[model samples]
Target: MKIIPLGIWGGYPKANSATSSFLIEDKGFHLLLDCGSGVLSSLQNYISIDELDAVILTHFHHDHVADIGPLQYSKLIQSQLNNDVKTLPIYAPNHEKDFFQKLTFNKHTKGKVLEENKEYAIGPFVIHTIKTTHPAYCLAIKLTVEGQSVVFTADTEWFVELGSFSSMVDLLISESNLYKSFEGQIPGHMSGRQAGLLAKEAKVKKLILTHLPHFGELNQLVAEAKQNYKGEVEIAKVGKSYFLSN
Candidate 1:
């Protein structure tokens, strides 16, 4: 399996960059993890809109799903051109009904509810979700394919159950959205050191710090995470791919 960062910044995008979005691919099936700001434009740099098979949203936050509208429109245009009108399946939580309803854009995209603790098979992946600690209701995702497993913390603070839930995964994509000094000031986001602590607690083979803060020397986050984690720790870069093996 290969996971690519389409946009790594948090809250809002930096100049010429984007907010939280990742693309996961395995066995020719492409799954977009989020559809945040600039994602639709950044995505074309890697693959065309039609190549995307599905999308799974963590929450209704603008930084996480802003491009969802554009994505639906892209499909609408593509269908008009080719006459191949297959509604792309978007799996998401229904915590906010208004946002959830907008996911269905007639012939372009359709929304599928992702229930807590329920397993959904999408192509070669088995998807699982755990509720996350965020302002808006969010679900942390775990995807397993052919014995290769990876967990994404989405947007969350340090939680005991989350550590247990991600135990022994091959890769942990964590939201390292704050510095150690400002850890608790942000009510729902984790600090660099907190991300490492979770990686150590979960015993993950590798860690990727994502949903990054826009300032304060990005390398500090990697260094802090490495202090607690023995595994490889990297700051997610847009357009970079992290490959996973079984």
Candidate 2:
């Protein structure tokens, strides 16, 4: 399994990093994690919007789901170019269904609504969702492909359940939106140290820290995570592709 990051940034914009978009490829199947505004243009650089097999939205925040509307409209319009084209199936938490409905403009319908703790299979992957501590109700995803497992924690604060939820995954892609030693409580986001500790406790093979805070020294954040985590740690940037094997 390989994860291609289209964009990786926090609440603010950076030079090349897009908001938060990830593409997981395994056994000829491709799954998109999120489609934020920062990744809208970057999507074209990686794959056609029509080529996406499915889009799993973690939450309904603008930075996390901004490009959903445009992506859907482009797919609908492009279906005319090829008669064999199919509308991509989107899976999101039940609460975010209303947002999806608004994006479809009420003309287009038919999408899979995910219930917490329910298992859904897409192609070669088995997906399970766990609730997270974000502003809006969010679902953290676990994808099992072949014998390899990958977990993605959308946007959440440091919590004990996060480690338990991420248990046994080969790769953990988590949002480290804040640097260590931030004087004030940011609320609804994780610091690099917090993410590193979770990864360590989960025993994941690799920890890819993303969603870098808008204003902070990147080097310090990376250093903070490294202090807590003994495993391989990297601050994911845009245009980087990570290859994983079972």
Q: Any runs in candidate 1 off by more than 4 Å, and if so which?
A: none
Question: Which candidate number has the best TM-score?
Answer: 1
* lDDT of each candidate versus the true structure: 0.92, 0.78
Estimate TM-scores for all models. Answer: 0.98, 0.92
lDDT tens per residue, model 1, 1-246: 999999999989999988988999999999999889999999898888999999999998899999998899889888889886877999999989988998998978999999777788998999999999999899999999988999999999899999998999999999999999898898889998999999999999999999998889999999999889988999887888889886
**Global fold similarity of model 1 (TM-score):** 0.98
Candidate number achieving the greatest lDDT relative to the actual structure: 1
Off by over 4 Å in 2: 15-17, 103-109
- Candidate 2, residue 177: lDDT: 85
lDDT of 2 by residue, 21-119 (tens): 788877777788887876767877777776677788888888888877787677666765665356577788768556856644333324668777879
Worst 10 residues of 2 by lDDT: 102-111
TM-score (C-alpha, index-matched) for candidate 2 = 0.92
